[model samples]
Target chain A: MAEAVDVAGLVDRARDGEPRAVARLISLVERGSTALPEVAAALAPHTGNALVVGITGAPGVGKSTSTNALVRAYRAEGKRVAVIAVDPSSPFSGGALLGDRVRMGDHATDPGVFIRSMATRGHLGGLSWATPQALRVLDAVGFDVVLVETVGVGQSEVEVVALADTTLVLLAPGMGDGIQAAKAGILEIADVFVVNKADRDGADQTARDLKYMISLGRRDRSGPSWRAPVVKTVAARAEGLDRVVAAIDEHRAWMTEHGELAGRRLRRAAAEIEAIAVERVRTRFPAADELAARVVEGELDPFTAAEKLISGSLGE
Target chain B: MAEAVDVAGLVDRARDGEPRAVARLISLVERGSTALPEVAAALAPHTGNALVVGITGAPGVGKSTSTNALVRAYRAEGKRVAVIAVDPSSPFSGGALLGDRVRMGDHATDPGVFIRSMATRGHLGGLSWATPQALRVLDAVGFDVVLVETVGVGQSEVEVVALADTTLVLLAPGMGDGIQAAKAGILEIADVFVVNKADRDGADQTARDLKYMISLGRRDRSGPSWRAPVVKTVAARAEGLDRVVAAIDEHRAWMTEHGELAGRRLRRAAAEIEAIAVERVRTRFPAADELAARVVEGELDPFTAAEKLISGSLGE
Candidate 1:
């Protein structure tokens, strides 16, 4: 097993600008195995540098097209970009079609642009259990900007994107489900909105409706300091992408200036760490399976089970 | 405090056809409190009798309208029905709008009809945590049929609907996001498909496309036995609702003949018990919090933590 992987050495190689090492590290994290702890420990010191952006919307809203456009815009500014595409599993085959990679074909040969597609694999969220680790690997590998594109507007997608530094919600004109999106959890998490295919007839109306829906939730006092902007875009043609990039930059700057960026990152990091800890306890303890069986059999309650499990683990 | 709610007594009263007791019992189950073990045990023997039909689609696909039509149809057949309309939490206030109840106003006073509106309440699935409990309560309370209508097409919603004995996916004409729905995990779990708003243009094409997609997934050499019928309805006018109900009845008959109905009900009961068990652990266990804190501190890993927690509980 290669002596359980030299996590520290791999991290060092990745930090030294070795692309293969970086890729390998990400693969390890994505596997989310027992060795993940060592890899995460090694990569932890190098993270907290990349600006993570989340792009999401209903499918066929041209999310990939918009992502490609945004990547091009960032590349034009001489910035290194990493794109993570979360793909859905094939219901028939239970494997990913890898359609997301094909959608972003233009970046296939671009060295400055790195693309990876992930599958949910039965994770409750539209992300893999190892997504956070993969992100850390990407960060340690020195990507200045990271873009996470969720496959669709499911609740898990929204929750996953909420962990990003800036979340951009993409919508197509004439979806007529704008209010539905707002009603669902997507509207609350977006820091910026893009009405892709703005050339369509109802684009203006959709924008107006979205703005109105947003204003309903704007308390004007206790929420975030900035208001989410609705940007119009023709992503395929790359029109209005500069404005999108500019909006993202402005949001980043505002977050940084207002201290919200660091605060949010801290919270996200805390959540990440907490999730990791719970996962570890579950993996290391043999009694966890028995407890689950008891709960399943209705012989023991879940809450009491949880308490006993934790107490035992802490040697109480 | 009211003697801490005599869970067994409440379950008995609900089973004896007391509406107030049924409602209160469902509330307890929905809350997923530490005391749920007692409540679940009391109700376990009384459940596994009702037909659970889950209806889901994007908002404005007329899911509510279709539900109303179905309710009217089933009621006309002298079948006692329970409708559980699961709505999303309001983006502005983090509260449920209860819009589904308003849309279902006609059944407000019908003695044979039970209408309940549930909020997503931060649950990832579109269905509320209390849904299974509510369904069980209804089943035990003597309702022969239960219908669950989810507000949107989310993975959670799909998962919730998948728990139902029959799942009907409502699609509206001219939505233009059918492929997107397919990608978002809607196409796989559908037991029956309804192309609502058949009066609208392009209904035929949409139906054709949906049929083709269904055909793509049918791999069973015995041919799935039950062909998912594509019923076209204009629910606003109560058009073709009879056909929808007929389709549901046909599915029920097929399941009964194949012994699938009993098996499905057994599975649903098991699932309900499993959910209740997990909820109990979550409620009684403080370890989740501790593990979460460790994850935040980067001192542990998530997967391992989850496994450890589960195993520890098993030992209890």
Candidate 2:
């Protein structure tokens, strides 16, 4: 595959503000090919400089719209922004539809904002296997703010977003089952919550319910201390965009004050490393087709078969 | 923690139909501790015998009621049934609410029926990492049929159900987002479809919509053509369960006739082993807390740190 893009060269070009090199680096990461190790090493020194924000919620909650608004608000302040919209990969198609761009049409022509759609690509985790590598490339390209918008809600998405410096969970009014939103477990991870479509009748009620739910947090100190601030927004109308941006900024400032920003970044790094290790084992094992065939033939017990494959490669 | 139960002893007892051993084995699987390797090995040969039926739907769609009715229907036919209800691990408590049991009260006194609830327990995939192992235990205990009930609709749950021999995607009438369900990509995986609460208004429209969707599939010329049967069920009234069971049986007959059973089982086994390999790597990696601290200190970049960890333990 053209010897996979030269890692050092790509990193150098990305650091010199070449968007093409940044795109190439992300492509290598997304593939999870052999060039990943080299690419990762090349971009190692340039990362840890960008402020990463994670946006997640249930499907059809208007997260893409809220993300687009957030991006525009940041760009309005003259800051370069990078948006990574993570789309779920279709197993049958082996590709993501990536309809997120349809919602962020305004940012497409803005030179200061870079938007890329990433597919999970059969990765178990909600984020793509190459996400960390891609983030490094974006960081190297000097994006002051990097926002990761996850495609769906699940434990994997939660874990991926936990890597972000600030995580915002978007919930829409009149979803009918407000409890369903809570059941998605997004409430626990959100540093800031937004009730989009605030013009709806139940917008205030949803905010109240979310606040009540947040007050039920049992782990840390209670009341408003561990509560996520609920912001009301009409993303389509761009109303309350300033308040949403201010809340984000306030959360960032709080993290910095509490020294949680550095801690969160560190955890994110550790999680990235752990994910990479797991990915290595997955690649070294026999292909799924081969293993399936063996299991079907009764030639190997799945447990023993898996053990042999894993231990033979990585050792228990 | 307590010398992790002797795998050989547990396997022997489970094979002899000891209830305690079966329960213990399932607990081991649910915890997904280091003891999993031994447990998986001991139970490996016992699997590939039970027919796995996976049931999934949106929450409050009466999935639990339908599952209960199915169990009752199967038991009435003199078939021994085992149900494994998968739920989200409570992030706040780490304990599963195990609400499925409350809906399955009728089976409480049935000696031939065994029901267990499994929490996702942070497994990257929607399934409990120990799912295959639990199934093996149930199979060894001589359950004629095993039913896997997934918690709510999402990618992970849908995927876990896809691993089953026959996947039944449940739906309710008046589901405001019937179209959203279609877009969620659930339609493609279902082998048998059930529209629960069929007495409700708009039920026919939902059924018609689903039938039209299924009709879009290309016809197969080889073997018995499998069409996803749409069954209407009012589970509270114990209505239409027979048709659902018949559809499952028909699917099984078709699978047996076409020699697809062995292939499907093999695929499931292969996936189980692949998951094990990935889990092993996760366990062997450094603790997340320590790595996170290093990243926070800026002593190492996430990429370089991850590369070092993976290369050191998992690479040649």
Candidate 3:
């Protein structure tokens, strides 16, 4: 662990667009370092510039292939690309979980590309605590686009939408992933739908199912409802990727026009801040450990235990 | 909210095999009622008699249909049964999610059957926070078997294993769910594996995949190794259902001889009690809202904000 004041030099290098510095900063966040406050403060000015995109779906959904294709398209437009792949199962950047990123080796030599795979060391914070700070590191390091890929439809993955200007939910044909999309409430979280492996037998039906499920979703009536367009693609072949990128751009444009781009960032920042605050308060609650024992012994109940914990944890 | 004394009466009736009392008690647990301590005290003696089984897998895996089948099997053995279906997507129980449970109408008129569909009510507790207490309510009311089911393979769903005496992970062929099971760390969480829709093409291959994956998991070195037996079942047709039940019985017998079942229950009780205490403590933390504002403003980093929140909230 570095001293709080010492992290500023690392932050300076990170902001100056040094890949090693950027990697070092993200590593600190992943490890839940004590000097995190220093890092966040130093990098604060450099964030809020990059376009953050989140890609998530069930495993084996060609999310990696789609991400690779999308990265190529973005780089063709001369954009600096950074990808943060969050795999909760892997505590470290183990080899097996990140086979796709290995396939992403095509981007390795390109100075315009930076990729980092993160596993949360199996902590309680999971994605909510680690990801935002990692995104901040990417944002601060001057990437034009930061792409996030997460697996599963759990609430943690859904929170990935908060960090993105647009969220691409990848599905495939013949796997019942479309019905999965509905059951996981992916219909509500997706900003754009990408049906990968579209050359398969039931691709059309999968697309139709997603469209129908999206129709049944409770629309956001705050303004004109943006219908999530379902697009089919053969990501392994890089076919239909141009259409996917076009959808991303159009969604980004819509976000800009409707002021949703700013709104998303604001909410993301707010959630990150709240998560941090609640976590910090957690340790200070007096008798939490003691009350827990009492509850286990049947001497107290949990809700009342919580109420007492709050009172004892708080100062006048 | 019922009065504390009134809840005692409800607990008594609940113990006396009253359905309305059982329903009211569970409702209180689900609503996170304030009289939780009183309820816990009353129900404490009646628990520890029920066996909890957690059924989890990805969506479209025929979990609910299979649960229905398993319930009928247990009821045939003259066992009273209760089901807790944990679906985070349904904020309120409505639509496609709970539809299968309704289809379990074969046991609808059985006086010995009780069923609950829980959707987390969009709370921070996720699955770990709610299910244990609900299990207690059912346990108090004298259900010999309490079956818990959860969707998806996210880490949260994996935590459901801690609450069950035996955790049954369901998978089907052709959905890529076998690979999904490996990816979501389901290989390690499953105590008994049910290959539902086993009559479908590639069911044999799917079973082979699970067997291979389980063999690959790092064996628990603390005791005699338990090899999670993979059982193929056409659950809808009720074929091979007896084999699945036999596997569960064998596992329970092994747990009993090894003292693992008691250990599992002790840990479950500890966790439920601790969660209640922590949840109660959360509300009393001082100036959490204030610190969250400072974090959003970038005036304070989350780590420092948490440190401050704890210090401010803690009493002398």
Candidate closest to the true structure, highest TM-score: 2
Tens digits of lDDT, candidate 2, B137-224 = 7876689899988887776575566468999989988774346666877777788999999999988988988887777653544555
Candidate lDDT (C-alpha), each: 0.72, 0.74, 0.77
**Ten contiguous residues minimizing lDDT sum, candidate 2 chain A:** A91-100
Q: Per model, state how many residue pairs clash.
A: 47, 0, 7
Backbone clash total for model 3 is 7
Clash tally for model 1: 47
lDDT of 1: 0.72
Candidate 1, B308: how far from true, in Å? Answer: 7.3
Across residues B1-316, which tens digit of lDDT does each residue of candidate 3 receive?
A: 5446488789888878787888788777766676766787777656678888999888898988899899888988999999888776756657424553575477767878888777764654766776788888898788999998887777657668888999998888987756677777778788999999999999999999888878767454555868899999998898887888899999999999988876776566556655654554345454556655554555566566555553454221
Kindly report the fnat of each predicted structure, to 2 decimals.
0.09, 0.50, 0.31
Interface RMSD, in order shown = 6.3, 3.4, 4.6
Between 2 and 3, whose DockQ is larger? 2
Residue B267 of candidate 1: its Cα lDDT?
A: 51
Compare the candidates by lDDT and give the number of the best one.
Answer: 3
User: After best superposition, candidate 1 residue A308: deviation in angstroms?
Assistant: 12
Worst 10 residues of 2 chain B by lDDT: B307-316
Q: Per-residue lDDT of B149-255 in model 1, one digit per residue for the tens?
A: 88766655755764688999888888744575578667777778899999988999889888877776666547456778889999999999998888888988998
lDDT of 1 at B207: 91
Query: Model 3, A1-316: lDDT tens per residue?
Result: 4555468788888767787888888878887787777888777756677888899988788888788888998998999999887766667547534664585589867877888877754753778888889988888778999999886667757778877889998888876756677888788888999999999999999999888888778454565777899999998898998888889889989988988876676667656765775565355454456665554555555555555554463221
